[model samples]
Target: MTGKINSENGYVKVEIHKVFKVLLSILLCFPVIGMIVLILIDTKEFSPILIVVMLLQVLMIRYIFIGLAFKFLSKDSLNRLRDVLDIEWIKNQA
Candidate 1:
């Protein structure tokens, strides 16, 4: 099947398995729990601060990984947008 995006089509087709989706949701809970812990605590200490920062770092890394994965997975849509814009630019130039 062609993964190319068309005007009639919305996005590139990328198959994400159900198992991975479930695992990803489970993994996301760690950060949420960490945030809840941080919110419940009242402290001016090093260890809790460190833990929160580490949790934030992990969440940020996860976010970046997901974003990059989606970008590469839906590249056909990006290419289609670029092509459409290029055509418009050429038409305007002429």
Candidate 2:
């Protein structure tokens, strides 16, 4: 889907692409799913310390992806993207 910005009644509306949304969702799920499968497949192979480390890693990855998703979907991010893209140029050309 195409991205668009609309301003009505002093509010700005931005439509983000579906592909990006889907990608973020996948990223958010991957680490948790991977860790779950790992634990299920070999609970005895990992020591307690190693399991703790792995859990920490999963949490860190999940946190990072969540932050990225929120940042990308935030209003400030949309405004920044618009500024970087120079929407006025496209408008002028049209």
Candidate 3:
């Protein structure tokens, strides 16, 4: 325990790192879904720049997975996500 409380029932307490990992893990799925949606739908009207940006975002998701697989990193390190609000790790994000 970090001696910090983030809601507890005396049976379970969530640590700052635990919450950070879970949120990042869940959000990493978004890019996959976006790629699928793009594949399934027609986007001929979309500008070339927009399509390129979307593909770059999709590519960044792979790096995010790699970062987590190697070491604990903040969302800023992950690049596509934001730091958790008011969480303890926000200060160490850099």
Q: Provide the clash count, candidate 1.
A: 0
User: What is the TM-score of each predicted model, taking all chains together?
Assistant: 0.39, 0.42, 0.32
Candidate 2 per-residue lDDT over residues 4-82, each given as its tens digit: 4455212344554688768766766765677778779998885657657667766776667556666666757656766
Model 1 C-alpha lDDT per residue in residues 1-94, reported as the tens digit of each score:
1355444433334555678778877776777676667667845443556666777767775778766786686666556755864532112122
RMSD per candidate (Å) reads: 8.1, 7.9, 11.7
Q: After best superposition, candidate 2 residue 6: deviation in angstroms?
A: 10
Candidate 3 residue 83 Cα shift, in angstroms, is 24
Whole-model lDDT per candidate: 0.60, 0.61, 0.51
Ranking by TM-score: 2, 1, 3
Q: What is the lDDT of residue 37 in candidate 3?
A: 79
* Candidate 3 TM-score, true structure as reference: 0.32
List of clashing residue pairs for candidate 1: none
Quantify how close model 3 is to the true structure by its C-alpha RMSD in Å: 11.7
Question: Of the pair 2 and 3, which is ahead by TM-score?
Answer: 2
Instruction: Name the top TM-score candidate.
Output: 2
Error of 1 at 16 (Å): 4.3
Using lDDT as the yardstick, the better of models 1 and 3 is 1
What candidate 2 gets wrong by more than 4 Å, as runs, is: 1-9, 46-94
